[model samples]
Target chain A: MARIVVDPVTRIEGHLRIEATVEDGVITDAYSAGTMVRGFEKILKGRDPRDAWAFTERACGVCTTVHALASVRTVEDALGISVPRNAELIRNLMFCTQMVQDHVVHFYHLHALDWVDVVSCLSADPKETSRIAKSISPWPKTSPAYFAAVQNRLKTFVESGQLGIFANGYWGHPAYKLPAEVNLLAVAHYLEALEWQKELVKIHAIFGGKNPHPNYLVGGVPCSINTEEVGTINTERLNHVGSLINEAITFVEQVYIPDLLAVAPFYLDWASVGGGLPNYLCYGDLPTKSYAEIDSFKFPRGAILDRNLAEVHEVNGRDAEEIKEYVAHSWYRYERGDEAGLHPWDGETEFDYTGPKPPYEQLDVEGKYSWLKTPRWKDHPMEVGPLSRMLVAYASGHTDVQELVNETLGRLDAPVTALFSTLGRTAARGLETKLVVHWMKEFYDALIANVKAGQTRTFNDEKWDPSTWPATAEGVGMTEAPRGALAHWIRISGGKIDNYQLVVPTTWNGSPRDAKGRRSAFEASLIGTPVANIDQPLEILRTIHSFDPCIACAVHLYDPDGKHVHQVNVC
Target chain B: MTRESGTTIIGIGNLLMGDEGVGVHVIRHLERTAPPPPGTEYLDGGTGGLHLLEPLQARTRTVIIDATADGRPPGTVRRLTPRFSSDYPATLTAHDIGLKDLLDAAYILGDPPDVTLFAVSITLPSKLGTELSDPIAAVVPGMAERVLNELD
Candidate 1:
């Protein structure tokens, strides 16, 4: 078996090292590692539980609001307070907006280059590109002149011999399947998506008070609603937000979703690739009605074991009996021994650098291999992300989710089982975006009605003060981040944070082996993937990027002072 | 298409890491002490990557402030307008937004803004805490003054 390592995998957030063992071109075994350690949870101890959002949100700048939302929700959950209905709708809207923006960015920018070759676009005829683009959706930027200008810009850039971020790409690799014209079209949208995303973040800034790290209060959202006062959610700003959502919806329907459907047919073979652990988990988010009512959640919380859509077992993230994290093959120490799986409330964060030193050819896979601890749902390495959420929703008989999933599979002429592969995972993201766009309208309409009915209340002041709290209280804040199921566990004692742990989406998907030697979702998915070239393992990148790995969020880290522990490892 | 043309001074780094947030410190100093040329945008770019493209694109010139650990003494600052990927420092702790990769993407796309980098030298901080250490904190005022002079 030839070992191939892609350290510091690019085009995704944070630091990731993927190594696979290949035999006769097909991967036989794979190992995934998160190089960075984020000790944010450790820092939270002894601090006021209210300030947890500020620190936890910094764990990932890209997915900032989710951590903040999760942090605040956990504190509120511990305090046993349900937020006002208006606050719930606003939060749902912010999250859904994040989902739309994030998924689009992931597809066109991060994952698309893996499939569509930018270099090949140089040969594309601008006229043909424009025609094909117009045929897919009426986005109105399809003039031949516009395509020619884009083509000229690309040509000039390529001729300059300075490929910038486009540098180091496996441009002409044999894996590239899109035609020149199609590639040019994708490249055009790729550029357009940059502008599209900038507009979407405005929604976050309007409600949450900033883009990267929005200001979130524990009791409720911080945004005020006074038409007569400045810096409030007034009629003009509300209408602006409404218009922005409309624009985002139009782009997703016309540009993003159609683009995926258009590009998907060329790579149908990917539907069978990268099918890892069939166990899936989703903490249902985006409540359709009220946060007080669990059944009103649009996403639906559940776990699917052994790919059995027929039997989706319920998952209670708060119950330590259901969810636990094991550090057996990770770079951490547990008082109960490395093999012991501990619940998040009892999660440890002691750093023990026991692996082989840097500049090594391969990891000590037999021992500690990754910084990410294996988080098991009932001792099962469950996959969490778009695929898991979609399947769970489908099994739960969410008719809208079922229709979208069924229609897409039918159009592809693929079986329902096909939903388990890399292509299905990518397609699921697009389908989920469509659902979110529809829901964005629903939530916005509800918000407007709430305003008209004079229910301008947004914050729940009942739990604003911590003096009323019990001596000890603990709660789990669970939700479906754009990536997957994310939960934050917090225990407050004497009105301060005592213990905090986060089982982020990437932690579940990119985990190391447990005591049972079970491979992570990332490792398991790569096992059967064929490596066309050891040097250019684009197949591995495609499968991994499809899951949208965010190692920065996965591994809880904090850079220690006065000590440079790592001698930077470059790929 | 070309972006809206202007100048934006963006500071990029992780504030959670003490010395690593020197760029933001420099920007904060500028915000407090000296004002920029009219129409010049000043932004807090916290460890951004591709998102920097929005600011980098459609601009006449962009200046970035970031902390760098290149075996130099803490508090040492250097100014250089990087023209190529090779011109950038070998490593930037900003995991998502590698300065080298961001510049390369723009240059490859044929619309790279003139980039001036204020690379402040500092040791890599391992632990998690808020305050910038001695040497780094002492240089913040000087770095801010230098940025203002560049604006002129």
Candidate 2:
């Protein structure tokens, strides 16, 4: 009875629970529990469409803009309206700003602890560690001080704020492979990265009117740009951000990349570890000066992966829709896959736990002991996230991302195939942030030009009508959250929400026993995690964070604020 | 001695320890509320260990909200400051010495805040869930306001 569990896998955005069953020291079963239940969808019923953007973004502070953009797009799709190009640019910028911070934080605070092994400092020659720390990136405010002072600051942070998370740490263990000096520099830069990430978040607040969840209107941004006054990116600050990006790039190249290469050889075992479901999904916008005949940004639209590698196909929100909510073995109802998933406008929820499951069509779905719904693409569980989107974009040559990736790969010494793994996935996320930031500047310029030209209308005042929504219209909207692909489905009938469903990023990465009662990605990855001790599931946590598991966008099913249940009003 | 020049509400305890950190959570909410008690400072001095001496050693008085491991059903309210030093440290986890040391420092300093301790009893000292078990969470509202009521 080999068992391993990281009760609360720290890092990432929200709350999560992971458990794995092992036989002969190898995990045979894995289950990911999205423990927190926030009733956003049920609460969004009968709400105004104008409010959905505001409310849905609050589901998760880190990816609010991503959520908001998706929500607004869904309504736009519903109404057949196009947001002005400039407005699109500005919204893209805000979302991009968020990505910058998210990537920086994830790389340093979250994943760095896993790779660098914080406790390894005990073995580090303080002189060499200090030399490496002082050389990498200096913290402006605290620089000029000796490396010993920096180390002391790290100690305080570890002891107090972080609590002895590094205590009894297994640094010299067989699993640890990175050089002591590289780890030392990474740890120091990890602290500097924290400061840099926080400043970038303030940029979101400056534009979106506060962070953790900004206030962006549907038509455009709620706040207009005033570069002369408020939009003042002082020369120093501007240069600082660019410099930080460069510094960050250097760190990723000099440290993270080399270290990943060193460690991969030791763990050549984990390359094939994960529930092998090759279906990938992506439905986010990109900025391409050259619009195709169909009017998409730079990238072509379609769901692509190794399965659909050669033949690209266009996919509307409708073609990529089919979800089933099974509460039989879960905390919530048992529903069939083809039953047309319910909407927030008409959904069912009960917190009582009764283990009952109904068999499915293809995969024999049974036993729903989770709050997560089974979301299958063409009736098969599909994986979604940065890796999926990147793979789709690269496999299909998404013009903008492809160009940037090719240019960067030409500079790296490693093979381009390495970009497909954990290191590439993480680095690509940062590159995507750059793509987003560039888009944001263009967005701001357009909005400002329009506003100064006597255009004060950043929002369209929609007198939402609750009675107009189809009594029974089943719809699902998918967007790229910072962690990966996020989706929301709703079915309404008789002027009330009947069923609402969401398949968050974690659900894709850390999925449970699916239709066939087999393992999902998170479970599959755990097979070779080599648990030294079940009490401390560090390896499992490392692999999980690498995927950037986000629980869900919470309970608010509405894309925006006003469309919440108490206020189901659409423009 | 009854009601000094200024009073501050400080919640101390582990947030993961159920109702133990209820005081801090409540204080955070209290701080976010407009028109707080005049000159009343609310601090979520999370187990600051030896760092407690600084905050407690100031102002007129301080209220320490914590889950005392005393033998009582969860949410049992016991009020004590440095006035009951001998029996106090034993009342909470050794991890809580951070709060006690600060209060002790404040008492040692002539400028101690008029202190009121709101000690909530708990069966489990450390666990997940911000919720207090049963009748305690139900009784917490009344139990929480008792200190404010006493001040009034």
Which one is best on DockQ?
1
Worst window of 10 by summed lDDT in candidate 2 chain A: A560-569
Clashes of each: 17, 68
- Per-residue lDDT tens digits for candidate 2, residues A164-268, read 223334455655666665565566566555444544555555556544456666455666434344454333433444444455445444544443433445443
Compare the candidates by TM-score and give the number of the best one: 1
TM-score for candidate 2 (chain B): 0.76
What docking tier does model 1 reach?
acceptable
DockQ scores of all models, one per candidate = 0.34, 0.06
How well is each residue in A375-468 modelled by candidate 1, as lDDT tens digits? 9998899999999999999999899999999998998899998889999899999999999988999999999998988899888788677778
Question: In model 1, which regions exceed 4 Å deviation?
Answer: A556-571, B1-7, B28-42, B52-61, B83-86, B90-94, B97-114
TM-score of predicted chain A against the true chain A, for each candidate: 0.97, 0.77
